[model samples]
Target chain A: MSECCGTTATIEAPVEPRVAGRIRTVALVGPPNSGKSTLFNRLTGLRQKVANYPGVTVEQRVGRLNGIGRGDLTLIDLPGIYGLDSYSEDARVAVDVLHGEMPGTPAPDAILLVLDSLQLRRQLMLAAPVLNLGLPTLVLLNMSDLMEARGGRVDTLALAQELGVPVAKISATRGAGLDAITHFLNRKAEAEKPVPAEGRIELPVMGNPRSYRQWATGISTRTKYKAPLSNEWTKRIDGVLLHRIWGPLIFLVVVFAVFQVVFSIGQPLSDAFGEVLNAGGGRIGALLGHGWVESLLIDGVWRGVASVLVFLPQILLLFLFIGVLEDSGYLARAALIADRVMRSIGLNGKAFIPLLSAYACAVPAIMATRTIENKRDRFATILVAPFMTCSARLPIYMLMIAAFIPNTPLLGDFFGLRAAVMLSLYVLGFVAALGTAWLLKSSILKASSAPFILELPQYRLPTVRSLSLRLVDRGKVFLRQAGTVILAVTIVLWILSHIPFHADLAGSVIGRLGQLVEPVIKPLGFNWKIGIGLLTSVLAREVIVGTLGTLYGADPATQSLGLQAALRHDLTLGGAMALVVFFAFAMQCTSTIAIVRRETNSWRWPAVQFAYMSVLAYVAALATNQAILHFVH
Target chain B: MVAIALLSDFGVEEADELDLSGAWKLRQLSELPIGTVGVVESLDLPGEIQHHLMHMGFMPEARVMVVRRAPAGDPTVYSIDGFEVALRRDTAGAIRVREYEGQNTRQG
Candidate 1:
């Protein structure tokens, strides 16, 4: 488990306070969507990934404040919350880090409060509680550009005098006024000792939030600041986007376009990359000349990396769309539109973002569930996320539909029989996910209903530079996974497949394992070869096509026909459909299970996830094969 | 014109408490028409819900406007302090508000 998941009990002495060899810790705290993450990114510069939206920063993200105090000042970017009170999990995390109660985090030497300057009065309600903490603190009035655009200005000096803290006006999105923040941190870091004026600060009028708001309003009057006019264009756009009749229709069209991009754009790029890798591997094999080194280089390392690298296009495109949607603030409106339908299935609107992302890949989708506040809602969302047909299942689906179903048009050139089967599979995946959540929520995970409160932030254009940086970071993560776990698994499976070097694969260790499991899967119309493909595919779903290719002794270069033609010669139509149905529900990826364990912080949930998915796959495949064979064969 | 006519029909009842002038009519926020602005009278809800609402800037005497409703018209969006917050109608029912007359004239 990562440091973020460590228990709250373990507390080592304050590490950063000693300052002899360690860096100073300064926590950046703010309310939801106040540009705290954007400021963190600007201060840390391309070294950190900006956590966008509310509750997205579930774990602690510490970044180095470059060029400040021996370049060793660590800036901890915390989850955006309303205040210090423990009303939600994200709020609790902020409180823990502020008080140094969480394991592996030391008491902060300073607190930097990032507030949206345009919404100063509303945001200052949060400012009062944090100011009462009384550590060495500085206030950052962010979004000065928007404030100016709305014909308003902030009296930074007057506000600073009233609050007894240094205040700087900055635009985190445009990278303005960051040097003032650096100077503030440097000045605070060089102080002789940590300020101990804990009880010196008076309560803002009184202790409760009502008094805090009153105090905040009073302080606003001293700054000679006028409330900026709210963005009328956002509400205008919402009139159409959040319309009673058109909102849901537009949402469906947007979702359809995303999937179309994922398939139409991602498929060719994957094929092109696969071809380049195969050509390079083939040349290396010829040079090494028919030995274990040749086999290991061509079949083990190259193939493993190739399998994982193929999903790069889909991952990049998925994050790109997600960035645009979230940065534009349309995701909140979509969640609101989806809330009505989702509530019928026992989930709140907040689960919609994670659930939608699951269509591209389940790993990131599962991670995105951190934004959901309710524990039961988050768990239910995670457990059913894998049931969505991810990009990994595309290869298996395409191979099956192409090899089994004819290319006859169903409704014009637009909708072919093959396309119909693909669409049905996606719909089936969503239906199954919804059904599982409904069952789980009503049965074992039932609890008192939690109220849903989602803030719909104003829309803004997504900058090209930030979007490209996010795209690159997501691509890097996917490639890194391909380099490590996926690479290792391929090598291990390669060794198992090639043991007893003198004999054929029919007599190898993997061959024996396949034969052993053949009878168990035979009821689902899978023979020994299919059994072997299923076993190797547990490493990744796409590996089944490659495994079937190697098992049939076909050339890997002509990927279009080698596997498809071989499968056509080997399997019946009923069996092909059964395989596709099985792949849809099977928990095939080891990385997904690993992520589940880490996210849930338990081995039991992943185990339960694996068991339930496998059983569901087996039963569905059996029924599918039996019905198809009885009617057609 | 229809919304204005509907607003003018609200009946105000006199209160025996200290300073209520019998000029404001109290109503559940969920009962207000879309786009109507109201001043929060009080949040008669469970302690946790009330605390969370206050923390989110839905304080007593704060002006809130009913922005829009979901497709099913159950969870409605309310604009408070320039932020749009969407919550279920059942949750909104716990909030008591009086129609805003230019500004909040009643003092605590």
Candidate 2:
């Protein structure tokens, strides 16, 4: 039994006439797990636009209230945050947007403060500071359906009286009680008189969490709030899922299943996609037959764009799984389980999801680092993500292993040499990532103390609409990158290789540049043609195979041989092994570099990452080649 | 105060051993067994972490139940104010709590 403090007396006067103006922009603010995003999707449907805030990686999502009968009313979904205190980047962004301090974002004329009714006693702590902002505020108790079903109770009329604002208990998931929002907006838009602030309860001291909690507890008691019982299924599931013995084992199984789906199923889908694109490009090329325009359009732009687009299936598959894990709240449990292992490497448990996703593509994985709250930990994770041996490295590894390693059985026909080499390459990338993370944590990016505070939200079934929206958004990001940066790089490479028009492959500008760098790579057992492959592979790690195929096809001496035969004839055992090793460690994907730059909001990080990884790759490959040569001699 | 006099009669002399209400003994949150509830007394952590934990419903007088330990047993989950949150052993050790004596086992 605590009494309301004295701060709310300042707002006891009638709401100013300007405050009742038509609500053009509404901001949705709430803590994590409050179902704020779900309500946003419900109100806006398919009309949301997601972008980053000015000069920050935090996402700024704004959409129109199409379902609320006011298609012109804009709703800005600020990042979910615990408090307005700016300890993290997300909270800072939310604070800026609410106060109209952020550039390129209109000031929210009203605020929709959504809280979980089941946890209103705790969540109501946010209402005090927010109400102090003096914007026309509506407190939306989301998840009220689940709350009531679990025996929770709340007196919305009494609560609204206490806070001096409208309170609506609605379930965003069930689409129940949503007409309250429309009614509120319509009434506010038509009303022009001053709103009398009667029955205004006192607020706690600003920025003091203890006083806020006491104030919240007093309000809850007065409102007769009854919190729901803990979900029985969540407890039972955690008893097994977080068990000492079963938890880690199940985590392994889940991770294995994710990768198996992404590769075993997604690979065939991607291959089919690639084939379809190639066939379509060929048909278009035949219409404009035999000219530089055909070559540029078909071989340069079409092939490059198609190769990047082919990854859409695998990226979507990875995101589908990520979306499910995230929406169902299993991602938090996974982070808790992974905290120990990740902490040993100087990263947080939340880093595990992004690192796990890096095996598919670093672009999405880097984007996934937004879940990490600490800026240092997020940056460290982003810098090391590209070393996780993504799918792009598979083609080069497969080609080299096929040309070099024999299929000799190592252990009674169970494991072959080729499989051993491939596994070793995977191991190499993981080790490099771990070692680099350790180095960074010990030196430049060291935090004063590691603070990992994660809330384990109650599990729920993921919605199909939410998952599909996630996939659509991810597909858009991947395609936009391919159409811009990848397309530009492809056009530039095409022009350089065809300089002095119709020149032989050896006499082109790119070939001369490759020969110019031949002396540097000779120590690693690479020829000038391999140097050219290295240069082209900077566009994408998988592009090396196509570059080698084209370069060797253009040579009269090796034209009669198959691509694999030509590679085997030109490269020694040491060089072939070194080539795969180089691909294993190098940061060769421009997509990853571009994403890293965008995520870090500076080129310094990607530049440093590229340089460090390249040096390491060169040194490792040199050791690999010289050691094999010495042993052979 | 009554419990303090009763404890004094049993030869316990340290006033610091009891919380302000003298109904329960004060201990670090990590020392509490699973299923046992405690009222948070104070936080001895750094400023940012302390604020964050408080924002997460770890304020003074808030009842928190030790739910379960992670698989490796370093971080433990605690239920506070109708929600569950996980904290590492070091962080939990900084939170001072008094063993709760209320009959409502599930209510926070």
Q: Score chain B of each candidate by TM-score.
A: 0.71, 0.74
DockQ of each: 0.42, 0.44
Off by over 4 Å in 2: A1-19, A194-199, B1-23, B100-108
After best superposition, candidate 2 residue A364: deviation in angstroms? 2.1
lDDT of 1 by residue, B3-102 (tens): 2333332211211122444546788989988867776788877766777788777777676788889877878999877678998988889898877444
Residues A398-490 of candidate 2: C-alpha lDDT, one tens digit per residue? 998998889899977879998899899999999999999999999999998778998998989999988998898778877878888899999
Which residue pairs clash in candidate 1? none
- Candidate No. with top TM-score: 2
The C-alpha stretches of model 1 lying farther than 4 A from their native spots are A1-23, A49-57, A67-70, A193-201, A205-207, A283-290, A407-417, A554-570, B1-18, B44-49, B100-108
Candidate 1 chain B, run of 10 with poorest lDDT: B9-18
Number of clashing pairs, model 2? 0
What TM-score does candidate 1 reach? 0.87
